[model samples]
Target: MTICKGVLNSNVLFYKKLKMEVDMRDQILEILTEQRPDVDFNSETSLVTNGILESFDIVSIVAELDDTFDIEISPKELVAENFDSLDAIEAMVERLSEEE
Candidate 1:
């Protein structure tokens, strides 16, 4: 019975974390859309590679994410991989939040 309870609790935590991640992604997409409404963020995975987002856009995104998430992104964390796609940005935010 104790083992079953533990498993159930773990599942609950997992789902909660998943939901949080989805919410974070949505919030990020909102910010991105507001920045560039014409661009299709959902389909554009090559934001940096394809020149969809330039250096200034990246700086703006970093500021928005920093303010929204209440976490400070270090200078070293400002890499292409961290801001390549919505998932990558979310992962970076989550990692920074964990560190804090």
Candidate 2:
């Protein structure tokens, strides 16, 4: 009975974490879509390298993300690789959120 309860608790925690990640990704996608309505963020992998998002766009996104997510994106965190894809942005946000 003790082992079963532990396994159940672990599963619940895993589900909660998975749900949080999905929610975070959805929020990030909304932010990205608001910044650029024309671009399809889901399909694009090379957001920076392909020149899909300009400098001003990045600035706006950074501000919005900071305000919405309550995460301070320092200068060092501002890199092309971090903003290159939806997954990258989601991963960055998760990392920052964990740090705080």
Candidate 3:
């Protein structure tokens, strides 16, 4: 049967789809915390050209996100203007996950 907006899903497929955002958020937090243990985990995470993260970190994060969520992050979306802060990253993840 088809479900409407905001309808709770008990099906397996629906569960996986619905949980993607929560999983992405947790994974992102885990990665950021592990990479920058000295930084304030609760505070904002600015990863773009602000320099908090280097090329390597970005590569690793992108890899992890791709593998974990099975979502392909395009180069155009990788710009500093788009994936700068944690909020921005979360937004991107949500958007990509939704598209999937």
Candidate 4:
């Protein structure tokens, strides 16, 4: 009984974490879509390399992400790779949130 309960608890925790990640991704996607309505963020993986997102767009995204996520994106993290894809942006936000 004790072992089963422990397993159940772990499963619950895992589900919660997974749900949080999904929610965070959705929020990031919403922000990105709002910033650039013409671009399809889901399909494009090379947002920076392909010149899909310009410098001003990055600036706006950084500001919105900072305000929305309550995470301070320092100058060091302002790299092309971090903003290259939806997954990259989501990963960066998760890392920053964990640091805080």
Candidate 4 Cα misplacement greater than 4 A, ranges: none
lDDT of each: 0.87, 0.93, 0.72, 0.94
Candidate 4 has its poorest 10 consecutive residues by lDDT at 72-81
Candidate 3 off by > 4 Å = 1-20
lDDT of 2: 0.93
The reply for model 1, stretches above 4 Å from the true place, is: none
* lDDT by residue for model 2 (22-95), tens: 99899999999999999999999999989999889999999999998999999888888999999899999989
Q: Candidate 3 lDDT, tens digit per residue, 10-96?
A: 566688966966777788778766766765545655666768777777777777777777789988777775557776777887788
Q: Write the per-residue lDDT of candidate 4 for residues 42-93, one digit (tens) a residue.
A: 9999999999999899999999999999999998988889999999999999
Native-to-model Cα distance after best TM-score fit, residue 4 in candidate 4, in Å: 1.1
TM-score of each: 0.87, 0.96, 0.67, 0.96
Winner by TM-score between candidate 4 and candidate 3 = 4
Worst 10 residues of 3 by lDDT: 1-10
Candidate 1 lands at a TM-score of 0.87
- Lowest lDDT sum, 10 consecutive residues, model 2, at 71-80
Error of 2 at 19 (Å): 0.2
TM-score of 2: 0.96
lDDT of 4 at 5: 100
Q: How many backbone clashes does candidate 4 have?
A: 0
* Model 1 lDDT tens row, 1-100: 9999999999999999999988998999998888878888887877887788888988898899889999998889987788778778878899998988
Better of 2 and 4 by lDDT: 4
